[model samples]
Target: MAMNRIADTTNAVEVHGVVKHYGETKALDGVDLAVPQGTVMGVLGPNGAGKTTLVRVLSTLIRPDAGSAFVAGYDVLRQPRQLRRVIGLTGQYASVDEALSGRENLYMIGRLLDLSRRAARLRADELLERFSLTEAAGRAAKGYSGGMRRRLDLAASMIGAPRVLYLDEPTTGLDPRTRNEVWDEVQRMVGDGTTVLLTTQYMEEAENLAESVTVIDRGRVIAGGSIAELKAKVGGRTLHVRPVVVAELPSMAQALDEYGVHGATADQAAGLLSVPIADDGQLTSVVRALGAGGFGIAHMDTHLPSLDEVFLAVTGQRAGGTDPTDPTDPADPTDPAGTKIEEFAA
Candidate 1:
């Protein structure tokens, strides 16, 4: 079978000069975005970067103070009802009714979307199997594990067969294994012709699932492009070396510096030393120099610049400290009540 096309410019999501403010705070500072149909666009940023706020505006849960947006050709401001018809949103936390069985939760959402009783049951059953929740379909969601709950949450979002899905930090708090599982599901959805706009703090997640990324910082878009393009903005590939013994760390660091590869650091916790290089040509010189210096290398890998480095370089902060679920402007651009309102809007 021919592979489904990921995105088409003829039909897509579009945002223009979008801005939202609360008193003195500008939650979304003239943000603009475009997501081609059937493709995944990863929104990357730190806390208070307005990622969730932008999601809310696109999902139609909150209106922007200025500018306009469209989903599947329907205006977000004037045609919210029509836009909602083609859109599904799954937030950071599972929104399934805990007291209800997994099947019941899916059925309920189907009903709300106007599916008949028989159709609702059939849809629920189909999702139960697809999400690997068939065995637990009859169980209350409250008793389900984190991964299962997340799957069910995604299943619920699909009940209406939405063409566009907004996953705002959907895997936030999931263990690495579970996170990978969610990523797999997202890939499957995109393969099946669903357009996904994912907001995430996990650089790995964005790298794995997103065809394009837009970096937001301080409520404004600092950068936007394909993953390779964004990585290029951060410079060339990174040369990572892991010595066999901790005692070799100092020598490895010095060797990296000798090659003019600065910012070399030893992560004792990971037992690895890494440095950024200007190009792939530096790799051979690095290996030869390390070997000549008598530094025994247990493992070495050269990788392109990751989104984590892009985040740090663009935002001037690390990823772990930024929480998209609860964004607060440490700069205090807005008043207490205004911040609360913006938080709720998110």
Candidate 2:
């Protein structure tokens, strides 16, 4: 394990008024993003939200119709080669060659990056062990589980030890447990002084991994801030109290209403009444007021707004609501090669 270091003062990535268009659709409508060295910035949005377009522009795979971008302080348009040298990108699906062994796939990537044959093999071994794929290194990637394949794809991206990494929904089809494992690896990567730009539908992943978040909706940035900051934009802490008996629900609602607090909608279906509190003092008052009403509280919980709530409030749709596996949706357009599927097309 490597000790985390402070990022260099130089910004690893900066995008100023970037715009990309596909026919009549605007994939990136004057989107701006800045990523400091050795930090993580999570780009969060639903399908067709232009997350992939932004990643493609930043990674040098696609050109923007307008606006300029810089990676490692090099202009993306004029110095694409330089930008490519310092950045790595892993897309939604695993990009490893299934016919190749895990070690072979990594070694090939290392070699492609101009590492010496021996050096490539050594790097492959190191990464295989680090990603816990050493035991299966010699097995064909097709035989590896989805988690292993995803890890191998990530290891391949690190062949050149990039200073900035772009992970665009790297855990799309992964199970919950596998997703956590990938999350831990990402934390380790950022801790090792690598600046990461992540686009994920998982709100919890954003909360866990991102130092800051940029929320996009309909090809535009609707909000950008730290997790807590974004949450505050939607609302304050929620005071939830569940009475022991269903008959007491009305009393609880009345008590909450007295403080100008509105109950959660019938959609929540928590069998509890909730009110938004402005601060900890309000929380204290709510508790005191509830106690005075002689309401036997079966449970009480105060919750800050989650990223899910923030996404809903900002986008008018829930995160992870769209079926990622749907083929007909233009949000996921397959390339002619069928090897690189654009998972979030606008």
Candidate 3:
């Protein structure tokens, strides 16, 4: 992870008012994204949020009906051929040939990128080792585990040593441990000076991988900022109380307010009361006040608002994923087919 390996580009990827449509469905409604050099920018939204569509447009697979985009300073439309040379794309699914060995897959990709036979083989070996697939490089990818296959697929994308990489839900099907491994690779890639545009529907994934996030919903950006800033929109520390007697909820809310707790809400059905407490001092005061008000506590806990809650608060929907079946679609499989070929190694 040497910093010198990094190729410097101030804004690796930039887009302005990108617009696209599928029949009557507007997949991207004037979307704008900016990814700085050697950093990770996450695109977060549910299934039909135009995340995939934007990735496609930026990667040169799909042209925006309106607006313009650039990758590695090359125009996505006018200089797409040149842009392809400096950018790599790994779709939602691992597109490596299952019948080929991990080494073979990467070698083939290198060759396709127009690397000489020896150069392709050497690059393939390096990628295999870097992604920890050297031992199993000879084995058919079909035999590899989910995580290993994903690693190989990612390595294939790196065969050309792309300066800007687009990863669409890179860990979609992997377990938590495997996903962490993929995240580690991404971290390493960026540390070495690669600019990454990562698209994911998972809130935790966005929080873990992104230096900044652009949130899109139904093909439009509703929010864009750092994770902390987005979370702040939902307010701060929250204290939850389960009263021994549900009837005392209102009295406890009043008591908590007297103790400087803000926005106390009660749920009679669940016999629970929630208060937004500024700090531990406010929490302590609220608890003391509850005791003084003759309210016994069944249970209590303090927690900051979660990403799902933030999504719900902003978009009025859960963050499970954008349901592909929705009227508005980004793309199928996060990889729109393209004929822009990478020349095979001579």
Better-scoring candidate (lDDT), 1 or 2: 1
Per residue, candidate 1 scores C-alpha lDDT tens digits across 1-346 of: 1122223445578999999997787889899899988899999876667888998999888999999988888888987887888888899889899999999999999999999999999999999999999999999999999999999999999899888999999899899898888999999999989999999876677889999999886677877889887776666667778888977787778886787656788888888888777766777777877887888888888775554466545443333345445554332222333343354447
How much lDDT does each candidate structure score? 0.81, 0.80, 0.81
Over 4 Å off in model 3, which ranges?
1-9, 236-308, 315-346
After superposition, the stretches of candidate 1 with alpha carbons farther than 4 Å from their true spots are: 1-11, 236-250, 253-272, 277-288, 296-308, 315-346
Please give each candidate's TM-score: 0.79, 0.77, 0.75
Q: Which prediction has more favorable TM-score, 1 or 2?
A: 1
Q: Find the number of clashing residue pairs for candidate 3.
A: 4
Candidate 1 — which pairs collide? Answer: none
- Candidate 2 — which pairs collide? none
Worst 10 residues of 3 by lDDT: 337-346
Mind giving the per-residue lDDT tens digits that candidate 3 earns over 252-321?
8887777766689999988889888666688778878888888889999987665445555554322235
TM-score of 3: 0.75
Compose the digit string of candidate 2's lDDT tens values, residues 148-224. Answer: 99999899988899999999998899998999999999999998899999998766678889999998755777678
The number of the candidate with the highest lDDT is 1
Better of 2 and 3 by lDDT: 3
Model 2 residue runs over 4 Å out of place are 1-9, 236-248, 255-272, 275-308, 312-346
